[model samples]
Target: MSGDDILELENFLPYRLNRLADAVSRRFAKTYRDLNGLTRPEWRTFATLGQYGSMTASGIGAHSTMHKTKVSRAVAALERRKWLTRTPDPVDRRIEHLRLTKAGIAAYREMVPLARGFETDLLGHLDEQTRRAIVQGLAALEQAADVD
Candidate 1:
């Protein structure tokens, strides 16, 4: 194949972005994983609930950009661990609001500082100029794509 015709996967924007996201997530995952044995989905769900106080499965899935199945499984796992509870809405029997229990809250609180520190460490690798440029570039891309 000619040099111009060859597709370099690593240099592709989407592929690069996806790879970077995965790598960052994996690095961050180690922190929460050690904190309370939380998988990515569980951590997302827990963090969502922790941030929002209470939310439905669909809400958590949408907010966290996780698949419904993953959200359901995380919910089940958290429930099994007595970290969260589901309550049927007063008027809507089909909808359940998920909230973290006191134990879950404690766990979430503990993870917060660790999560913040991890982010600080990640950003610390980049100089201020590069970090600002990256943030601006990502924001521009998101705006161009009309991402919500």
Candidate 2:
């Protein structure tokens, strides 16, 4: 097939979404990275635990769409920083439940406002209607893709 008949990745929905997500993530990463020297996986794991209270490494990986190795490294990093603790599950000796420490909670609280500001700054560039439309369109697309 001719190049003209081939799909353009730049214009593809999946590619566009991935590109947008990476750009947004990098923009937001600066806040946590500068404040706490956290990497993307570490930040994601920390945020997931902060939001969800306690969960297993597998749960965090699933929730954040991260790989097992990434989750493991993040967990280890946070543990070394005294920001998270792991407790052996009573019913399952092989499973460990992870939770944020007091320090982690404090960090999470400090980062919340920064995260909100970052989101506000980005969304503020768009008009109210456009922002609403973007939100609604994203929801529709997620539903269409059968993503939770």
Candidate 3:
């Protein structure tokens, strides 16, 4: 293959985006992990239920972009910790609705301010113009990617 056929990973958009996403996730993970020993999927599952009240495992997976296995594991972990309750549907025993328990709500409330602070601090590094540009660029990228 000639030089023209070679793909430079360093200059690739998808690679750069993936690296940025991983770094950001890790940074935020430290906040919740330190407080609750939660993994990324666990945190995502908890936060999704906290924000949206109750939902089925498949619903959580779709809403959070997590795979079914990840959602199942997170839900199981949270249930074991007594942070969430799983109630079987009245008509469909196979379907279970997951909701944050009082303890989980308390934990979520505690994290809300910290989560906001983290976002604030992260954005504080950028000037207003750059921040607006970044937000616009990301919105455009999401649209282009057909992200719902």
Looking at model 3, report the run of 10 residues with the lowest lDDT sum.
111-120
lDDT of 1 by residue, 1-148 (tens): 8999999998999999999999999999998888688899999999999999999999998888889999999999999999999999999999999999999999889989999999889999999999999999999998998786
lDDT accuracy of residue 3 in candidate 1: 91
List, residue by residue over 20-103, the lDDT tens digit for candidate 2.
999999989988999999999999999999899999999998999899999999999999999999999999999999999999
lDDT of 2 at 88: 100
Model 2: lDDT equals 0.96
lDDT (CA) for every model shown? 0.94, 0.96, 0.96
lDDT of 3 at 94: 99
**Root mean square deviation (Cα) for candidate 2:** 1.2
Q: Could you tell me the C-alpha RMSD of candidate 3 in Å?
A: 1.1
Tens digits of per-residue lDDT for model 3, 1-148: 9989999998999999999999999999999999999999999999999999999999999998999999999999999999999999999999999999999999999999999999999999999999999999999999999998
Q: Would you give me the overall lDDT of model 1?
A: 0.94
Ranking by TM-score: 2, 3, 1
How well does each candidate superpose onto the true structure, as a TM-score? 0.94, 0.96, 0.95
Per-model RMSD to reference: 1.2, 1.2, 1.1
